[model samples]
Target: MRLESVVPLIPAELVAALDHSCGIRTDTDLLFFGSSLDIIKKLPLGTVTLSDLEKFTELVAEQASVPGHRGDEILAGSRRISEKHSQASCGVKELDDLVGGFGDSRVFEISGAKGSGKTALALQIVIQGLLADADSCALWIDTSGDFSAEKTAQLVRHFDLAVSDKLLERLQVSLGFNIEAVHDVLDALRNSLSSSRTVGPAVQWIVIDSITPLLLPSLSAVSSQGHAMMTTFMRRLRELAQTFGITIMVINGTSAAAPFNQSSAFASTNRKPALGPSFTFMTDCTLWLSKTKDMPDSEGPFSVHVAEVFRSRATRSRIWCTFQIRHGVLSSTIPDL
Candidate 1:
């Protein structure tokens, strides 16, 4: 009845196939994990089929309970009942109303050029999550070196939220200078997730403050491999989001484009997000952040930043909202046009 005796009874090909698909690095990975073997024990002894093993693998993955209901549960609901859209806000009313805040187990891609307040908004999200709940946690993968602790502190105080060690400690920051370092951080997260216990405040949010800089350097040199790596990284991110019910926001730099407000229709501008089509398809929502021409000192002192929901799975309505940084915090205004 022990796992060692049961392991030999299972076919090697089934194990190999599972390893390839599940990224099981070693044999120990297949045998270990406290609950995994428990599922396998239900199968008939000394006669394990591939179907049974596959079922066991699926049961193991289900350990990471998603925030939403399963497909079967959704289908079983009354036909007259409408699907509910649950979202978590970032403490910004206008922003929340626009994109329905950040949904659970979804990826939000914020595309903008440099100096377009991407980092500012990202910090605000972390602050919001911490402020929303005392135990809420967030992770910042600073590949672009744009995150600032001092500024975050200023915003935390600006909101009049308690600036205690516990609140500050809730937000974890990892500065990955190179792609290898980024991979290392992801590997650590994966390992941490394998355990049944909660790891590091049950991380609710993960922000990659601009993923372009890291991949852009090598993308030209090894286009195929670079694209593949980027895709894999995003896939792993998606898995993490689904498994941990974390909201992922990846900062993407956009190519410059001439301003075109010719028609009311949402036109696709030359300003494309980094990672091209592959990334667009993978993202659940894409928000383009752009800056209009600077206003004169008389018109307005601060520069205006517009956030357009160019692509979204939740709603088709094209939303255009404006926000400005005041006292190191972003204040979102009503939609303009």
Candidate 2:
């Protein structure tokens, strides 16, 4: 059957041309709706009639085959996405190679025991991100009040000195000790994104220095409200990440004991992220940072930390990368001993 022959068989009154202006072009878009009510809502009220609804099913059955974009378009798009992911960096070359860089619009958690260098890793990532591009901005949410001006300066000094101050200016810090305060910070950020008069560049990353503080107090045995509150907070975090296309890094802690009736958050390890299972569910990637005692994990004077991909949608198997801090600079590969 000729493509043109099938087209004239359908009445023009029954179905108008599926154009971009109408927000539908193919069967896929039309099939996305559950019923005619949704399609009716898309049009001006009363333009579509009961008669149209009557023939809607028949309209679908005899629908003309509309040509979508070329099939090669999907492969091209996938390649572009692959290239973008390749371009994204975690500020550490070795770590980026291991689990792939922190790509767009996702939540990544850095979890470890107390002395395992979680904050250092996150700080390095944000500072590097800031230094890489002048237009790039970031937000540091200080839950435990660990964010320090002097410390951040010390970290960025390892990169470029000429533009360090200018880049540092792009980073904003807010002390959000409680859940409500964090929500308020996000609300303010959402508003800033909406307002045209906003002077500052839109942020690329949001780093939460130790999510444990903001959440631990609420996970109580006496009340389910705590968990409910936690759920709401996590959902909001997810929404902000998706809506604003920001990469979120949350610092978390590990607990010796697992939650009741559930395996460890990362099945390969016994120690679990302290915020409970729901936190893990919300996270797109879990980059587990830990201080290793093994000889292979270290070289000389620097304290070598092992970074493992506990959970990542992009990776299939467990992958680990080693990093160390030398002269206040964090590097995935230790410099010549």
Question: What is the clash tally of candidate 2?
Answer: 0
Every candidate's CA RMSD:
9.4, 12.5
Top-lDDT structure, candidate number: 2
Q: Could you tell me how far off, in angstroms, the CA of residue 264 lies in candidate 1 after the best superposition?
A: 10
Q: What is the TM-score of each candidate against the true structure?
A: 0.69, 0.68
- Kindly list the per-residue Cα lDDT of model 1 for residues 212-274, writing each as its tens digit: 877676565434655655655676687777666678898888754447332113465546677
Displacement of residue 14 (Cα, Å) in model 1 is 20
Per-model lDDT: 0.65, 0.68
User: Per-residue lDDT tens digits of candidate 2, residues 76-171?
Assistant: 754554553345675778887766676656788888887678888777777776766567799999998767898788777667778778878888
Where in model 1 is the C-alpha error above 4 Å? 1-70, 73-87, 197-200, 220-223, 256-270, 293-301, 334-337
